[model samples]
Target: MRILLVEDDAMIGEAISQALKDACYAVDWVRDGQSALSTVHRQRYDAMLLDLGLPHKDGLEVLRVLRAKKHSMPILIVSARDAVEDRIQGLDSGADDYILKPFEMAELLARIRVTVRRNAGIAAPTLSNGMLSLDPASREVTVDGVATLLSAREFSLLQALLIRPGAILSRVELEDRIYGWNEEVESNAVEFLIHSLRKKLGSSTIKNVRGVGWLVSKGE
Candidate 1:
């Protein structure tokens, strides 16, 4: 899934962006509230990581404006502002969750998953397609009663497909979901990962249409 990361601190922003990418998430980063506002209107993000302090406009104002316009994208406030009032204000302004600064990357990723799943109205952490089972909370995959070890990119690719098992996703769409804005993608990156997953999950686990794209097998 794609995430919008808004932070003005160069060091902090870079760190978060890299961490998100490492976790197999697509990230688009912006440095100011105005830019954040503009991107929200222009781009499709599964969730947003917002900071309270921002330039050209306060992040809180951005939150309020987005909520005012009735946008339902899940927003998580990640700031150094750990005060109770700050947390309350962020939630009141439409943020779905709040994470204090100096936070653990794992926790941030977990919260992002929770926020996105909550938005999707999905309560189960384990997503399944046919005989394949993936536990998002545990980051584990089991197929046909056997466990499978998948790389981060492999898992992300499978999750993207399992989320909508029979839906065909173009290479560009899968790439958009699998890599961050800054990552270098080889020409056959998706094919390579798809090969790995198919090798492990079963050859028929995924199918490719010559020029169309790829998709997980549909259940009978």
Candidate 2:
């Protein structure tokens, strides 16, 4: 999934961005709140990781502004503001979750998954479309109860489709899910991933809409 990361600390920002990439997320990071606001307006992100102490504009104002404009993507505050009131205010200002600084990367990743799933109205940890089951935590897919291994990019492409079964995603849409800023995207990357997934799962598991795009059926 795509994520917008807002932080002012160079070290922390680099670390977090790398971790997200390692976990197979497409991340675009900005070092300040103004950039954060501008970037969010220009691009679609599945979720945002925001730090409260920011330059140009503070993160709280950023959160309020986005919510005021009716931007509903999940926002998680990652700040050193540890006071109870701080947490309450961040949430009240529209943060879906709060993670204090000096936190574990594993916990932050887990929380991001929960927040994103919650926003998508998905209660189950594993995403499924009848014939295929995907566990985000394990990065594993099961076809008819049998485990199947997938390369990271393959898993990402399938995850994008299974996130909303029956919804068509064009080449650009699927590419955005698997690639991040500054990453090289080969011309046939999307086609390659889809072809690979079909072979591993089943030829008929994913369908093409002729000139439109691709989708997975919302199976029973």
Which candidate number maximizes TM-score?
2
Runs with alpha carbons beyond 4 Å of true place in candidate 1:
209-211, 217-220
**Which regions of candidate 2 fall more than 4 Å away from where they truly are?**
none
Against the true structure, what is every candidate's RMSD? 2.3, 0.7
Q: Which number leads on lDDT?
A: 2
Q: What local lDDT score does residue 201 receive in model 1, on the 0 to 100 scale?
A: 79
Residues forming the 10-long window of minimal summed lDDT in candidate 1: 130-139
lDDT of 1: 0.87
Q: Write the per-residue lDDT of candidate 1 for residues 168-211, one digit (tens) a residue.
A: 99998888777766689899999999999888878988899889
Candidate 1 versus the native: TM-score?
Answer: 0.87
CA lDDT of each candidate?
A: 0.87, 0.93
Q: Which ten residues in a row have the lowest lDDT in candidate 2?
A: 143-152
